[model samples]
Target: MKLRQKAYALAALLYLEFSNRTRRSSLAEKVWEDSSAEQAMTNLRQTLLHTRDVESRHGFRLFEADATEIELNRDLTIDLREIGRIRAATDAADLATLIDLYRGELLAGVDGLGSEFGQWLSLERTRIENQFAIQATEAALRFGGRTGHAALHKLAERLPYSDTVCRATIELLRAEGNEAGARAAYAAFRNRLRHGLGLEPAAETAELIEQEGAAPVGAQPRTPARRSTDIQPDDTIRPSFVPRVVLLPPLQDFKQASIPRHLAPALVEDVTIGLSRLKSVSVIAPHTAWQLDPFSALDEVRSHQIDYAVESRIAPNFTGDGLSLAIRLVRAAGREIVWADKFAFSALSAQERYWDFTNGVARALADSIETAELQRERTQRDANAYSHYLAGRHNLRTFDLPKIRRGRKSLRIAREIEPEQASIESALARSYVVEWVLRAGSDRALLDKAKLHAERAVSIDPNDGTAYRELGRVALFDRDLDLSLAHMSMAADLAPNHADVLADFADTLVHNSDFNSAQEKIDAAIRLNPVPPDEYLWTLGGINFFRGRWEEALRHLSQMRNPEPAFRLMAAAAAMAGQMDLARRYRLQALKLQPDFTTSRWVSRMPQRDPADVDLYIEALRKAGFK
Candidate 1:
């Protein structure tokens, strides 16, 4: 049987017709982000040609396009036109008709419509749900029972976290003496709410069940305010723009107990608290977890609008090594385990072991979350400043000037939106350092500005290691080796596993004549991030230079992203190895980047401790033709 296929076609149709005029390039890029501009243009042409064919073959006139622009045919009828008109009407009959017109979400059953399209769909889907919810609620109240109750049920499910609808539905069910049915509806709503936000039913909803005095044992009401362990409903009606993370109950099995099971809630709490501290993430409470049925958790996660989930389990090791705690972090869209680790500890007190394990996992989680969420931010079409901040950080990893400037703007926008966010301040500080060192080395004012944000980042949250790392970089650029190492060391202690922190510390170590330790830390940084940033390569090259491995130094520096620094190092390394021709070639490259560079001035600015080594560096650069 032939199945219907309309999503991509409709998406193309709508995009061409939405604004009444669109560039074919813009449309293609929106519809196919993975495709090249040339490919996108070709596909756009083919699709427009195909739409024209459909008109001739099936007698449907969707739209038409020219080389650079597309405009919908004036006579063609659009479904959205009808939806918009019906939406504005005040009559119930029109609302019902509008509701019926939404058979499903726009561009449904579509795949790979690019991030821009996905964003449009997300906003449109949200708009549709909100409008449908209001109308559905009103109709449910007006129609009364059977159909009204059914409409209420539909609205309740659509908005699983809504307390008002659930309470109303329960009351209506109770009024009809359908106590069993009422109980079933409340359970489903509670399950959905718990599954979505890890929140319990509101106090009012809970009282509805107990008022009858026939409440089940599991449905017992809480007499006091919310405890730390309990999940609370969101203050917002819908999920916010930040990446929403949910922590599920930690156990070896749902049907079977793991380590007596009582310790599960505390462990989940640890994860939730750790994730909650990051300004970038929005964490669902552990209280909303632990109690929900494990089988139903996955289905409810989507309705909750969750991005990632943290789950852990403990079991005895097969090798008789006591037990292992296996914690996994997964993204909802792909269910991919972005990070996971298993820790083996002696069967000591659960509380003590939990703290020890969580400390390590929490730090690692912070690092891994940055990487995962950055990926998420890239794919988000309607991401907010937090998302912009993530994207900026990711781009800044390259340490290039154009990208750095772009990243700086993103971070500044993020800071403006969330002035109290320490992470954005840290990132903004680092970007300033990059811009100052690479683009405006003579600009003392930029250094001062960078220092302000670095200090502010620390003042805002003294524990944020990235803040200290940036402070160290600022000091390093200012040639204050002692202060640089001091801040960097503190950063290492605070964020021992963060790749950026370790890399920054390694840079400070190189300047302080601690090559061996620097190599160790930088290598560790590389192991933590297999694709270490370009700055890591620069640090590694510097280490080899001090170790007198000229060939190795040249090899490492040659692969650095920005060839200016790479070429400068290469010139010295080649001359030190007595390769006159290669030295001349590299020196020419370095001079091309900084024509004013001279051996006397460059050597004087060197951070090396030994006068003899400084003399050696000058001699090498002179051999390579630095004036």
Candidate 2:
């Protein structure tokens, strides 16, 4: 039967006590421990209602509850109860049956629950593993030959840290006249123990491989030795598992009467199907995703072993002519956003536009997952290509001149290790772009290098939107406006849900004198990322300055945490708005950061469709005390 929250309640009733019963207050407190006492009681009632619904569908109830207590239906056959009955068996057949019935750890990935559930689950898992190890080892010793070897091997895999299981497997292999297999198993286990757990196997485990007869069967399992607090668990080292993602049902808060409610859910279904096509990640089925609460119940979501979650919300844009959909890809571990963007479409857009929207969501989701996977691959440090790439990518985003150079060095090392890697090449190109801009467009060599690396990245992987985005920036700096527009348009088409790409495209549009379109694009980008990077704000400030909204320009620029990059522009905006004191302060800050500042050099490097715009900027800068 398909059970949800009620499953945990059933497990507690079945296994927590010998009577298969619990006080209603106690059960509520355990399962809904994070909620208030009154709320917990309410939740308990709702959970039991859910159980009744399941029972109606399946023809029988698993739970019997009263006003004061909840109990498992005594007549129902439960697998866990059956397992509990035979947990202490000594017979080889009974123990073998128990081993076969036992699955891996209980509630395997369900963590971050309430404290009471977390404690109970941990103790329960330990109890099961401990009992299963003893019984399996005993079973393997009693049932000799190939069957015995198989039993011990299964036990070893289930409890890799168990020295007793390892010794048993090694001896069983030797007794079967497979000394080579025995030695190989010993070597593998020893390496895992030393490297993975950072400790050596017991002396008895080592002696089995050197001499031989048997490693002394029927020995009790060893309690794990204490280790440094910094050591991570086994799952952290195993990066080979495929990442699982769930596309949650979108939150549709449409105030517009014309916008249909079905549109958001339809988009979610389309994106889910698109994500399922990618083999690198596994997509949770739509039925399951729909049943999950996207905003709340994250602990229950993580219980399904979801590595990432794609959450979306749909609403009408400020302009009533269109609908806006915001999408965010979040890492389940830390609940950090890996990527997020907003897409705007007309209420009655073409079917192809919807297809384009879903495609962009899928592509960006895949790219973000790849980057997050790289960041998680920190176990091997410098030797791992992923580590180098992550370091370069992280530093490159800082937008500092020296850090950009350092980022370049790391990305170059990553490229050497994985020659023809498109991600590294794209990042290398971005580093050059940042360095070129940071140097105030004086470094022509940086643009050429950026173009070269971007082209190589495109050649290596034409689908990479980041490569096209970098190439667009290079062309913009090179004064090739037409080429820059084409490349930027292509980048946006390829990754429509990429906020940075949209913001960059908007910046290019501002230089091309498309102020209205640029404003719309920047607004959408900001909506995609509620807490935007300083660069996005800087771009918005520039767009406003060019559009002659000096007050708006100053307002946007003032929001930047580090306004040093745009201090001169801020000064100009402030002066034009008649805030002479603020303007002079900003000018002093700019000169403090760059004493050699001159309006002539800055205006000459500035890109604008009309020379008049540059003249006006220079005029404002002069008023703000710039030489």
Candidate 3:
């Protein structure tokens, strides 16, 4: 990259990694600060010349490009991309590869890299390292005996001071029928600790090694810890999660009795559908509220748990030009009028009225759900694919795989039309996540494609939640819990009430061994939409298992009719609860569904909250007749 080209590329990547949907002018400003727009364009042009495969008008395609925008190249073999892929792999070799691939901080030597970009890269690096340490420790514990010992030893050598790895070494020795050796290992670790850092082992670690001299035949399993009291249930009933609403039919006063009777209901339906689109608000059917006929509108709002009540009136213009409409938004809890507005528009034909009503209602609801100060601009992308992508996204929420596939296809077409459309690329990437979860092998390539697309999306529109959400899914699959958490949290902050955003956040929390917080989030998800799919319920069961509430887990797991791989895994948890018969039955059923199901495979699937929990699960699975 030439100096100017390098500056532009660096600026583009910085914006891509940090900003949300940056405009060309904004990017130009950053690249050519204090310079005129013409100069900025000149510099941008120079930057484009660095990319050998890109055309001049393509606007520096990081991934791909089209007429309006340039995005991060999805097929580009960037270091961050490789890091994400390697981090997600479950196999030891993949983990090793990930450690190797995460060579240094992203864009390490780029002089003009913004502080925000530097911070993001720093945090990402920390998360990757933490995950690497945790996984290495778990591997050491799992492969401490027989031919696996060398792997464990290697892992210990790589992460010398990791308490988890050190403890794993001690446990491994004990498992191999080397009681004296186990004691010696623990003593060595203690001596190393005292000599190197002059600190004692953690309470749990000290207890584990205390009985080292006369080590038992087998390692005793540690009991699950109780949840701390600081963790409380998130039952805050905000206006956002309320499902019911009441709308007074628009009352019209006209001198001539020529008004259509059906007009009011049509307007009511329009408003209802518009409000319902907002995940936060659920509008009560007009018919139900009309039938109730309370003493006053406020009474109706109080009785129905309605968060907002809308009342409207229409009047014919005496000049025979237009109709005037008045609308009011009232707070149900306080019976206080929050916002009242009036709109006047030219009298329309019946067909125009129908379209106007829908558009008007949609705009109003959109305004209502939106926070007071917008954090990010919700400007429509200059790509037709965005519309198709949105429609596909709506369908994906229903969990209809056929519909999701169709949506993915629509996104792909959109991608073809506007290849650099970050929004579409993000949507396309998320579709891959769904496909991957559903076991669609043909769509597996989409996962890699999705990561690249998501990276590009973020590059193009760093502030867009969709891109972050897609990237988070990729990170989750890669088992990079830290990156997953960061991305998911960003998505949630950007779109707080979005169901999928909350669900992904909850899932990451579960994987990170924060089950208490995960339960709270799952509860929030259920409250956001009472009837979440079976997968969400299955995750709830996993949360219960981690929290040591086996019966609760079994209860939730039972709700899943067609058992997924995750549901079958719950059988091992059932065994931990001493429900051996039930565990055995579920295990057999799971094995029937997945003949390859084994203790090792099932244990590996589990999110390692506590190493003892892993052992408990393995022991339970073995007892339940799984190999």
| Candidate number of the best lDDT | 2
For model 2, residues 101-197, the per-residue Cα lDDT tens digits are 6677676666554544554464455445655565567667777776677677667666776766877787677777888788778777766765664
Q: Compared with the true structure, what per-residue lDDT tens digits does model 3 show for residues 419-459?
A: 76666777777777877777623344767877988899888
Worst 10 residues of 1 by lDDT: 229-238
Off by over 4 Å in 3: 1-234, 237-306, 309-387, 398-401, 440-446, 602-609
Give the best candidate by TM-score. Answer: 2
lDDT order of candidates, top first: 2, 1, 3
Candidate 2 whole-model C-alpha lDDT, 0 to 1:
0.67
Superposed Cα deviation of residue 165, candidate 3 (Å)? 68
RMSD of 2: 23.9
Error of 1 at 463 (Å): 0.1
Q: Is candidate 1 or candidate 2 better by lDDT?
A: 2
Name every residue pair that clashes in candidate 2: none
Q: Which candidate, 2 or 3, would have the higher TM-score against the true structure? A: 2
lDDT of each: 0.62, 0.67, 0.57
Query: Residue-wise lDDT of candidate 1 within 306-334, one digit each (tens)?
Result: 55566666655645645666666654433
